[model samples]
Structures are given as structure tokens and as C-alpha cells.
Target: MGMSYRRYLYGERVYGCSKCKTHLATIHSMISRAFNGQHGRAYLFESVVNIVEGEPCDRPMTTGNHTVRDIYCIKCNTTLGWKYDKAYEVSQRYKEGKFILERNLLVDVQ
Candidate 1:
């Protein structure tokens, strides 16, 4: 046999896309963000497909006015995460072109 497709675990096993079941990312994919009042700390990412970026916003948060973008599932248009454009203020500086996917946004499939 060959390598079989992998599945993610929640209450049950999942394949991908809560709406479309399209395999996007893997279990190891990590999305971390700060100062989100709703989620409190960091978001999670099972898979990411689409990214919609707009003009820069001037909100003072992580790194102060980090350019924000919208990440979505390419198959079903589910909003998954947001990408930061610049990393001038961050000490790590690796987050300049990274995203933060919400854990709640993902759905488990079989």
C-alpha cells in the first residue's frame, strides 16, 4: 500500500472544508494571533485556501496597525483566517507574511 489520506480529530474524524470537504491544510498547520477580544488568545487552522487582502488599517494592536487581510476556504468561501502584511513592530519579524486562522471557523469531516 501507499500513503493514505490523513484525517483530523475533534469529536470525530474530519477530512477538510466544513462546507465543501476540500483538503486544504494539515493538522500541523498553526495560526497564532493576539488581542482578539472574541477568541481571547490565538486561533486554529486545519486548512486554508483563499486570501483576500485590502488596504492597510491603522488600528493599534500587535505591532500597531499591522495590515490585515481576510483568509477563506477556496472551495466554499468560509472565512478561515487573516494575514498581516508588515512586521516592523514585531520582535520575531517572521509574521510579516503569515496568517491567523480561527479554530472555530473550521469544521471536522470524514
Candidate 2:
């Protein structure tokens, strides 16, 4: 059976992966609820996993020093999106507050 996202919205904290039965964390937007409406729930986020056996980046760093949070699927280990600290700073500058929205979390229910 598919995961019940609706249930997660209603205070169901522990989300066990249907396939692997691993507990998943519930991440929500730190800003307005508008993101919630767009995501059809109260939050849009994921977990991050270490990429093992991956080649090191050879590209030069041009974006400056910034911390990023990556969202991933706890069960399938799917990467959702990266939330940069700079992004939050920019949003705050526009009075948008602090919030991370993962575009991949939006379901195309059509």
C-alpha cells in the first residue's frame, strides 16, 4: 500500500517506509502555509543520505561558503532537493521568513 501523506499531516509523526519499514522524519515548511497548500499538506521536505563510493567534485567553488540541507526518501533513498542557507537568507530579506520547499514533493495527482 502507498504511504498515507494525509495521515502524516494529521500528527502521525512516525512514517515507516512501506517497502523497507524504516522510520522517516516529517519535515515541514518553516514559513507560511502557502507552501503547504501548494504541496497539498503542511510541509515539503526529506532526509539526506551520504553518497558512498562517489567521485569527489573537481569543480571549483564559486557559490561561496553556504550550508545546504538535502531531502531524500528514507525508504527508497531518493533525493528530493537541496535547501541552501543562502536561499533562506534571501527569502528572509523579502520578509518571506525561513522555509524550505522541495519541488519534487509536489504530487501530480492528475
Candidate 3:
């Protein structure tokens, strides 16, 4: 395995992995906070960093069926949330290529 390097984010409000404090996303990138996850509330982000994406698989969600991959914190390898690879619903197409991070798994690092 190659050596892994994590990126540090600088923003007015930064969100990170609660377990390891590794930067994930910033407030500027957040699209919505009205989402829900397995653990509870989740936030949708336009982009994210310092994480690893697992294999994509089909999953049925409240909105619709989607192909998603579980995302893990690079520093601690904790399951933070998932990334949308393909959205099956036309109305949910906007979520493709985006990421979701569980609120309970995040910590404000600003």
C-alpha cells in the first residue's frame, strides 16, 4: 500500500471526522442539511476530502434507489457516510457525484 496523505481544510466553518478530526467538508460546500442517515441526520455536500470511498452498490432510499459507496475517514477509518454514484430518479439526479456525511459523525472544526 502507498503512503496516505490527508488534506487540511481552511474555511469559516469546517466539518471533520468526530473520531479523528480529519477535515471532510466546509460549510461552503454543503448543499443541504435536511437529509437523513443510518445514524440520524445527515448533510449533503457538493464535495468532500480526506476520505476513502468503498465499492458502489445499489441501495433503496427515501428519495429513490441509488448506487452509493460508503465513505470512510482517512485518519480513523470510521464510516462517516456514503457517496452517490448514480441516482435512479430524475428528480434526484442532482445528487449524483455528491457526498453525504452523518451529523453525528461530524465535528465543527472551524
Winner by TM-score: 3
Identify the runs in model 2 with alpha carbons over 4 angstroms from their true place.
1-7, 11-65, 85-99, 108-110
Q: Estimate each model's TM-score.
A: 0.56, 0.31, 0.97
Go through the candidates in order and give each one's C-alpha lDDT.
0.52, 0.34, 0.96
What is candidate 1's lDDT per residue for 10-59, written digit by digit as tens? Answer: 43333355566655454455554343523444444434433334455544
Candidate 1 vs candidate 3: the TM-score winner is 3
- Candidate 3 per-residue lDDT, tens place, 1-110, comes to 99999889997999999998999999999999999999999999999999999999999999989999999998889999999999999999999999999999999996
- Model 2 lDDT per residue over 1-110, tens place: 76533223323343333344333333332333344322344333343222111222222123333354444444455543334333224433332112233433433211
Per candidate, the number of residue pairs that clash is: 2, 1, 0
Q: What are the per-model C-alpha RMSD values against the true structure?
A: 7.1, 9.9, 0.8
Ranking by lDDT: 3, 1, 2
lDDT of 1: 0.52
Error of 1 at 74 (Å): 1.6
Best by lDDT: 3
Error of 2 at 91 (Å): 8.2
Q: After superposition, how far is residue 50 of candidate 2 from its true place, in Å?
A: 16
